[model samples]
Target: MTARDEIPLRDADQVMRLSRMGSFHQSRLSFMRILLRRMRNENWQFDAPDWHVNENGVGRAVYTVHGPSRAYSLVAFAHDLPDEMRSDRVIATAWDTTFTLFDGIPTDDDIARLAQNVPLQEAGRISVRELTLSRANRSARLWDFVVANLSAGRQPDPESLKTVGYVMRTTAVYGSGKFGAADHGTIQDRPEFAAPFQAEMLTVYLIRCFVMDLLDHNAKCAGGKRAVKLSPKLRRALGIGNSTGLGMAPFLVNHPTLLHQWIAARETALARVRGIKTVTDGERDVMIHHAKSAHINAMNWHSQHPMQIAKVTELQSDMVMLCKEITRIGDAPYPWDRLYRWAAQNLTSEGLEQVVSILMEPYGDVVDDLADAMSIDESAHFYIDGTQAMGHVKSLIAKHFDWALKTDFGAGDEQARFWYVSAAKLEPRLGERDAEQGHELEQPLAIGRDVAALYRAITQDETVAHFLRKHPEHRHILRRVQMVEKFPYAEIRDNLLHAQMMPIDMLRCKLSFFGATHFDPRSDRWLRICMFQNAPFPDELYVPGNWVYPEPTGAI
Candidate 1:
C-alpha cells in the first residue's frame, strides 16, 4: 500500500530520538527470530559428537548442527578458572569456558590447534576455518548452587533460575574476521547465514546447548548415580547471557545504512499493522494473549540501575492500565492504531514500545518479509558525492540535521564526553572530555557535533569537492550528509558527546533488534542481558513458535 493508502512511517526525528530508540522492543522482524524460523523451516539436525569433561569440569565438547548444505560445530573448551581470575570486563584474560564455532566438524589436530588459542582470547589467534571465537564466565553463585543441588539428586530452585537466568554470561563473542576468523563475506551468500549476525546468533545458540550439557556432565561427575537432567521447561529458561558495553555503541553510528534498514524495517512493519482497518477476532485474541505475556515478562524483569528500575515500575503500571483499557478495543476504528495512540498518550516510552512489539505479534505474514530488507550493501553508500554543490549539501544538513544545528557543542557540558578506543583492550570507551586526555583522538562517533561543525565551515556557493580539497577533515561527515539524504535514520539526532548522553540507549536499541529480553543494566555504561531465553534448542527447532515471549505461567 502507498503512504496515502496506509499510515505513513513514523517521522525520523521522532523515531531516531535516543529516548525512543532506547525504548525499542523486539518484534517479528528481529534477527534472532528470523534465524530460528529459517532453521526450523529447513529441518536442521543437531548432535553432540564429543563430551569429555571430568568431575572438575575441565575438558572439551563438540556440538554440531548439520544444515541443508553445510555443518557448523561449536568446539568448547571448559576450564576450572579460579575465582580471583574471573571477570566480565573485556580486558579480563581468563574465562571459565572458551569456544570457537568451527566451519565444520574439527579433527583431533584442529581441536588441538584451537585449544591453544581460544582460551587466550585476544592474545590468541585462530585460523580462517573458525567462524567465531567466544569465551564465557560462569554465573558463580548460580553455577555452584545448581551443581551442589543437582549433585545431591535434586533440581535447583526454580526461583533461583528465575533470578539468575543463565549459568554462564558470555564476555565476548568475536566474529567477522576478528582475530583471524573467517570474514562474514565468506559466508554471507549461504542461505542459512544471509541474515545479519546469523553466524554469531548460531554461535550463541549452540553455546547455550553446550552450557546446559556441561551442567549435566558436571552434576553427574559430582553426584554419581543420583544426578538427573534438568526439566525441559527449566532448560529452556536458561539462555546465554551477554555482557555488552560501550564497544558496541559505535557500530550503529559507523554503519549508518545498515542502521537505517533496521529501523526502517521495524517502522514499516508498524505502519503496515496500523494500516489494517479491520481486526479479525483471531488477531484480536493473539494481540491480547501476547500483551498479557509481555506484562508477565515486565513484571519479572529485574534491573539494578535506578533509571531502569523506575522504567520497569512504570511499565508494570502501564501493562495494568492496558489490560483494563483493552476491554474497549472493539469500540475503536483501526483498533491497533487507536491502541498505539492511547499508549502514546497514557504510557511511558517503555510501555509504548511494548505496545508496538505486541501489535506485530499477530501480523507476522505482513511483517516477516521485512527482515529480508534489513541487510544493506553499506558499501554503496560509502562513496562521497563530490559533484554536489555546497549549497545542496547545506540544504541536506538543514533538512536532516536540524537537531544537530540547534545543539551548542561550544559549551563544556554540551561537549563533555568523547568516544575513544581503549589502549588496554582496543575496545571503544566513552571518556569525559573535561577529565580524560584523549579528546583530540576522539572516534568519529559524535556525528551530530561533527555535522554542526561541518555546517559552520561550508560556504553555499562551492562544490563539495572544492570544499573538501581545502579542508580534508570534513570528508567523513560530508559522506554522512550525502548518505542521510537517502537513509533518513542514518544519524542519531542527539549530541552523543553531551554529558547527559547515555551509551545504554545505544546498547538497548541494538540489543532489542537482536531479540534480547529482560534487560538488567549494571550501570549506565554496560548491561547484562539474556539471549534465546525460552527459545527452543536446535534439536527442538520444529516448534519455536512464540518462544521469544514468555508463557503466562512463566514457563517456557
Candidate 2:
C-alpha cells in the first residue's frame, strides 16, 4: 500500500517569508519522518555482531542492518584518547572514536580493508562501496555515566539528558560522492533508499541504535557476568547527537532549487491543511491536540540564543491563546486559516512558522503526498539555459527576486566580508572583505550581490547565450536566475558579503524542519542541536505515525 499520493500547494508569498522560514517547525516533512516511515514500511532489521571492547568501551564493533531491498552495516572503530581530543570542530583529527556507514555487509576482507581507509577520512582513500561516511566523538559529560549505570544494571538518571542529550555527537556525515564515496546516484533508486540524504540518514538512524548496543557491550565487558543490558525504555532515551556549525550554511545557498523545493513543499502542506473545507470532528480535535503538544515541546526547548529564546517565548504564549480560540471556535468557519492569521500577528517569526509546521500533522495525507518531490538532482540543472533570452532573465530577476535588489548591500558594513571555503577541511567559512586576505579564492556562493551584478550585466547583452559565450565564468549565477524564474523562493535574499549576515537564521530555517529541538548557538558560526527529543523509540515504529505530536510521557 503506497501512501502520500497527493501534492499540497502553498501560498507563494507566505512560503517566501524569510523570518517565517527561519521559524519553521518540524513536521511530517522532516527527514526523520521519512526515515521512520521507510523503516516501518520496509520492516528493516538490525543485528549485533562482534562487539570487541574492554570494560572501558574501547575497541572495534560491527553491526549490520537488513533493509527491505539491500544490506548495509555500520563499522564503528573506537580508540582510547585523552580528554583534549573530544573537540567537535572540523579541524580536529583525533576523536574518541570514528565510524563509517558501509554500503553492504562486510566480509572479513572488507572489514580489514575499511580498517585501513575509514579512519584516515580524507587522507586514506576509500572505494565506491563506502555509501555514507561520518565520524563522531563521545560526549564526555554523558558517556561515562551511561556506561557506568548500565554496568550496574541501573538506568542513568533522566536529568543527565537535560545538559548533554546524545551519546555520540557526529562531527560530520558525508555522502553523495564526497571523499571518494559513491554518490547518491549509485543506489538512490533502490526500493529502500530514494530521498536526498537517505543514505546518510540510514547511517545516523542505525548509529542511534548502535550507540545503545555499544555502550551495553562495554558495560558487559566491565561487569563480566554482571553487566546489564539497557532497559528498552532507557535505550530509547538515546538520540544521535550532531554538532554542526556554519558548514551547512553553504548547501542552502548553493542548492537554491532544492532549498526552494523544501520550503515550497512545507508551505504547500500548510496551505493544503487550511484549504480543507470540511474535516471530521475527530480531525479538528486532533489538530487542537497536536498544536498543544507542539506548544509543550516549544516550552521545553532550551536555547540561550537570544533570537531563538525570544521565538520560543512567543510560540509558548501564542499556543496558550491560540488553543483557547481553537477550542472556543470548535465549529468555526475557516479555523485553520483564522488560526494562521492569529499566529502571524501574535507569534514570533519562528513561532508563527512553527505553527504552520505542526498543523501539517493533522493532515498527514497532505504533507506525505509531497514527500517524493522533496529530493532534487542539483547536478542535473547546473548548466545555464543559454537558449533563454536576456529579456527573460531580466524579467525573472525583476519579478521573482526583488528582495535581492531592495537590500542596501555593498556598503562598508554590508560588503565587509566574503564567504570562502576553508582549505584545511574544505568547509565553508566567512572572512572579511578587507580585514581578511583570502577574498581572491572565494567560493561562488554569494547570490545576492552577484545576482544583482548579473542583472546589470545582462542589460548589455542581446541574448543570454551571447552573454554566456562572452563570459562563461558567471555561468553559475546565470543558471540560478533561470531556476528562480520558476522557483521564486529559491534564493535567500540575504547578502553573504555583509557583516550583518545572520548565518544562524539560514541554519535554523533548514534544521527546524528536520524536527530538531533546542537550537544551542555555540557561536554565530556553529552550534549544537538535539533531534527526536520527544520522539518515540524504534520499537514504537509500528504504532501510529502521529507519534511525533504525542509526548514521550504520553501527554497530548
Query: Which regions of candidate 2 deviate over 4 angstroms?
Result: 1-14, 223-229, 534-536, 545-556
For model 2, the run of ten residues with the poorest summed lDDT? 1-10
lDDT (0-100) at residue 8 of candidate 2? 48
- Candidate 1: give the clashing pairs: none
lDDT (Cα) of model 1: 0.87
lDDT of 2 by residue, 1-556 (tens): 1123233465455565555556666778887777778788788777756676665667777878788767888888777778976678888767766777788888889889888877776666667988867787888768888878878877788767655667778888888888888877778677556655777777777667667777888777766676688776555555677888888988788778888878777777777777655556787777777777777666666677776677678778877876786676555556677677777777767667767776777776666867787777777767777777888888888876676777667568867888888887678888988888898888897777777778878755477789988878778888888887778768776567777667776787787656666677766777777665445556677866454443433443
Best by lDDT: 1
- Candidate 2's C-alpha lDDT? 0.73
Residue pairs clashing in model 2 are 10-268, 23-350, 245-526, 414-498
- Model 1, range 1-556, lDDT digits (tens) per residue? 3121389999999989899888887777788888888888788888755888877889999988889999999999999899999999987999999999999889999999998999898999998999999999999999988888888999989888887688899988899999999988888888887778888888898889999988888898888899887778889888889999988889889989999999999989888888888777877777777888888888878888899999999999999888766767784568888888899899999999988888888887888888888887777679997889999999999999999899888998889999999887788999989887988999988898889899999865788888999999999999999999999987888888888888899999999999888888888889999999988987677863567767875423
TM-score, prediction 2: 0.92
